[model samples]
Target: MFILKRQDVEISSIQHPKRKQNIPILTYQGQSFRLISVFSDHQQEEAKAFWRELTDHRGKACVLLEETDRFSIWGKVSLEQLRAEESSNSAVSTYTKACILVLQAVYIDVEDLLGGRQAGLFQKDITNLFEKLKFPQADSPKAVKHWLNVDPLSNSSVPAWEEHHLITLLQELYRLGKEYFGNTNFAQGVRDILQDMPANDQNQFIDWLNQSALGQLWQ
Candidate 1:
């Protein structure tokens, strides 16, 4: 089960009294979504209230929650439900670029092996990994899994992006959050902190452990 409040970005998993962490919630930008593991069903009152809140905002906003699992992402619900109004050349170009950039990010991680002795051995895997997707050329699942194994900072395969282009894309994402949910800012501070990260030394590991938000995401 899940609930969404567009006014904020939030996502949460529902909890039972017996659960270790009793907070039955995942909230993203003040919007809350929940996954119910113990309760096999929704209470009538809870359902009614949730339905009412959503219906009241009908055309104004949207939310999506899987009935079996509590998972949610803002604006995705409405966007998926509603067909895009019009198709434009610029929109097509934007989609293609996003697809290409994401794929490039994946490819850079392995491109170093392209001319090496390992190339023949991994060729099939690489081909399959880059196979086309509904979202055009997206990173293959295999590549993404490999990305998960990599330490973002340690990996020497970071993708190249024009400084202006990278900043523009990031800024666009930031503005989307601000315009819709009023987050105002996202990732900027994190990026700044990352830029200031000290070189690996005796204290590097501990300092990184303390400063990193990526590590906290799993928890």
Candidate 2:
């Protein structure tokens, strides 16, 4: 069931949603597995299943966890508990690893679309993507839920992916774009979009993310 967290204090869960429940998520480059199946109860078994689904032919995976003390040596912990400890906690550390996985996937996709990896175009898109990743969000999910409750653009009608969740997605797209576009004028494209949009629209920083060069890379 793609368990995001479990721990001694409390188990915080973030299910992938009903639609994605049956989908076979690609954990890494070559290994693919169906989340519809059950995860083993034993920690070693659980770790093995996760490894088989994520590791490539060369036995490498994008996700990494160096701080092993966060859990009861079982590697079971939730995102919520991790965030509660402190600003710099194991939860953030784990999420950072997940983010890297997302980045690698998207970057490869962009490269496929653009043609071949060109240094010039890649640098521009990479720079733009990095800037968009800097937007700050509330630490608590409650704040985000409150915001989405009021705003139309933030509605749950669309599969609501947390902004923090997109870090990996954006990183992947940036990598893919570089591999495909072979170094073109990505930044200028973003600038042009900003220039054409209304001043009020300019106030919405995420609009840059929603409808510009950065957005395109994200797609």
* Number of the top lDDT candidate: 2
The sequence of per-residue lDDT tens digits that candidate 2 reaches over residues 150-218 is 322223232223333343344344445444646533322433333433455433433535432244443
Return the lDDT, model 1, position 20.
36
Model 2 gets an lDDT of 0.35
Task: Please report, in order, the local distance difference test score of every candidate based on alpha carbons.
Answer: 0.33, 0.35
**lDDT by residue for model 1 (21-106), tens:** 32334455554433211111333343333344334533324343334432222232322222332233233333223323332333
The window of 10 residues in a row where model 2 has the poorest summed lDDT is 65-74
What's each prediction's TM-score?
0.25, 0.27
Instruction: Give me the displacement of residue 212 in model 1, in angstroms.
Output: 20
| Model 2, backbone clash pairs (residues 3+ apart or across chains), number | 22
